[model samples]
Target: MSTPDPDPDCPSTPTTTGTETYLSGGCHCGANTYQLTLPAQPSPPFPLVDFDHCTSCRRTSGALLQAWIILPQSWAVFHISSTFDQSHTVYASSVVTAGALRKELGGGEPKSLVHYASSPGVSRAFCARCGTHLVYSRVYEEREAGDGPEGEGDGEDFVGVSLASLDKDSLERAPRPLQHTWWGDGVPWLKEMIAKGCEEGGIGAMEKLEGYQ
Candidate 1:
């Protein structure tokens, strides 16, 4: 599938409240959902988004180009389902090391989100029902458990949320993506499509929007 222009209705508007910012997103089938929070700052990077033109992303997501939002694992919380109504515990260490986690939610697995090992240490998560690519995660440490550092993964675990899965309101309120990655792998028409999308359906009009100006 080709990466078509973003819907004009989702104008990339990004929202803010006292001392914090938030963006809501999910899959096409409402099977995967999440809320991303950005701590208050002098200037908020509400949408630290990236457009990925990598072959892996394109083939897996079936889109011409994949747009992803970069977030630190510790900086965001995720909930599954159409509505953000579920709960779980995060184990920076092993859940077994902590008592509260065992009783707080289901077994210690990424709920409902099926993951595929896209590479040796990279996992690509997607919705089992709708096939919407949710998040791409990469492991930082590869040594066997108890053999490497105290933790199974290095502190550098990363998360990349699919930007196209965001809600219309969140999309409209979101900041423009930071930049395009793997642009060289994209088709020759990719740049023209982006420019056209910006002019017609993307964040090009955002600067003129109220408050943003």
Candidate 2:
């Protein structure tokens, strides 16, 4: 997919409150639904962006890396009351040392954050039925233990959801992605574009290799 253009007049500061545009999206099965409120201009700490070269994300989405939009934990809403069957099948890709992956995957953990082994401490959640990826979270060790990999105190919670899986037109007015990450795992041609600061394809090369896979 082509990257969307960034708003020229967008601002860099974060907003505490305003009449922002709200958009909604859900899974193909409609089991998972979410709503996001975007600023009229570029808001620092805006929710979504593209992630590149994340191994678990690449495998899960079958794409170079998943597009992640961050939603305010307060503003984001999930409704699985009626679709529990579809919602329950969601899988946790890696093993957790403290608890069962399923238990660690859900809410209510003191310092829980979904994690993928490739990106340790980074947690990812996805649909169990159609395999639609949902969100990713990470532990907040800074506030918890003063300084440590494993947290000891209460940590802030965060999630990154796949923009493509959202309901239609939800991101119609959102800002374009701002950065690319994990470029090391990105295919060679893609790496070249990054080196040259070009925003176009390495897709043709990827396509050529598809037949072999």
Best by lDDT: 1
Total residue pair clashes for candidate 1: 6
Residue-wise C-alpha lDDT for candidate 2, range 71-126, written one tens digit per residue: 43444544332223323332222323221333544655322133343365656665
Off by over 4 Å in 2: 1-18, 39-43, 81-120, 142-155, 193-213
Model 2: per-residue Cα lDDT at residue 139: 57
Q: Compared to the true structure, candidate 2 yields what TM-score?
A: 0.58
How displaced is residue 119 in candidate 1, in Å? 1.0
* lDDT minimum window of 10 residues, candidate 2: 3-12
